[model samples]
Structure formats: C-alpha cells, structure tokens
Target: MDGFLDGLESKMRAKTVRDIRALRSNANLLREPHSKSMGEGLFELRVRQANGIVRVFFFFFAGRRIVVLSGFVKKSQKTPRSELRRALRYKADWEERFGHGRS
Candidate 1:
C-alpha cells in the first residue's frame, strides 16, 4: 500500500458506490474472507470485469475488510511496467499530500 494503492480503496468504494449503486450491494459479498483467492500473500489483486474489458484492482486487507488498493484497465501488452511505476509514484504522492485512504 505505498503508491497509487494508498487511497485507491476509498476511490473504488466511492466510485463503485456512486456510479453503480446496484453493484454496491454485491461489493460486500465480494469482500468475504474466502471470496479472495491467492497462492501467496505477496499480491492480492482482484479483477473487475465489464463488457469485454477487465479492470485490474488490488486490495489491502490488513484490516477488517478488503480495501480496494488500486485499479487500471487491462491493456493488450499486459499493463506496461512504466504504468505500474507511475501508479506506485501516484500513490506515494497522494500519501505525501493527503495522507491515506480516509483522506
């Protein structure tokens, strides 16, 4: 939870709530402990699918529920490393300026 992921949880929650009210109800269900599956705890990425595209998202569950860490629309070339770096930097700047998710 360093860069872009810092405040992403709140963004996803807010946007997910404001734009997709219907889906909002289902979000909690998606947060179930067993709902998330991962081989190792190193990465806990989640994919939100819509139409024909998939939006990649991660969660920070070092707390009560899964907090959406960050998100991006999947690209054909597998999400360039530069983009990942930028995302991380963005998260860092956000934290430096605003603080954390609650901000």
Candidate 2:
C-alpha cells in the first residue's frame, strides 16, 4: 500500500489520503461512491480524482480496527479478480498471524 501511494501523482495521492482519513474517521458513515463491500468481510475504500480512481481493500479486525490489505488504481469498470485474490491473501495472512475475526 505504501508503494501504491508513492506511485500515485501528487493530487491523486493527496485525494487518496484524504479519503482514507475519512474512512478511518467513520467507516460506517461512508457509503456507496466512497466505500463498498466486496463481501466476506472485505471492503474497498474508493478514492476518485480527475486523473483516476483508486481502490484500497481492507477489513475490520479485532477491536473494530481497520486493517488495510492492498490498493490499486482502477483501470476498468470492474475490479480485476487478481487484485481481489491478492487482498484476500493478505487478509488470510493477517488472520493467521493475529487470529481471525474479532479477537
């Protein structure tokens, strides 16, 4: 995710950071255009700028913490399966290390 953010252009990066802050502030208050669920405990934080759209995948962990898994720039109307798989893999790895679901 750090690499992803670093690769983004300045304006887009700033927008993405602002959107992420909004997500952290109140994920439940974020809906549609801003956030969307991918099912199976995964959600995407959507960040759109004049340049492009970005999606940061994350999941709620123990103590209601948001664990960001991966992020990618959206190049198509639909999200690529590979990215979803990658996020799921990260989620699995996190669960393995920290214990699944809520503590």
Poorly placed runs, candidate 2 (over 4 Å): 101-103
Best by lDDT: 2
RMSD of each: 8.7, 1.0
Instruction: Report the backbone clash tally of model 2.
Output: 0
- Steric overlap count per candidate: 3, 0
Question: Per-residue alpha-carbon lDDT of model 2 for 1-103, expressed as tens digits?
Answer: 8899999999999998888877777887788988999988999999889999999998999756889889999999999999999999999999999898675
Q: 11-46 in candidate 1: lDDT tens per residue?
A: 454443342333234544554321343322212234
Query: Once model 2 is optimally superposed onto the true structure by TM-score, how far is the C-alpha of residue 55 displaced, in angstroms?
Result: 0.5
Where model 1 places Cα greater than 4 Å from the true spot, the runs are: 1-45, 48-50, 56-71, 100-103
- Listed in order, each prediction's TM-score against the native is 0.36, 0.94
* lDDT scores of the candidates, listed in order: 0.41, 0.90
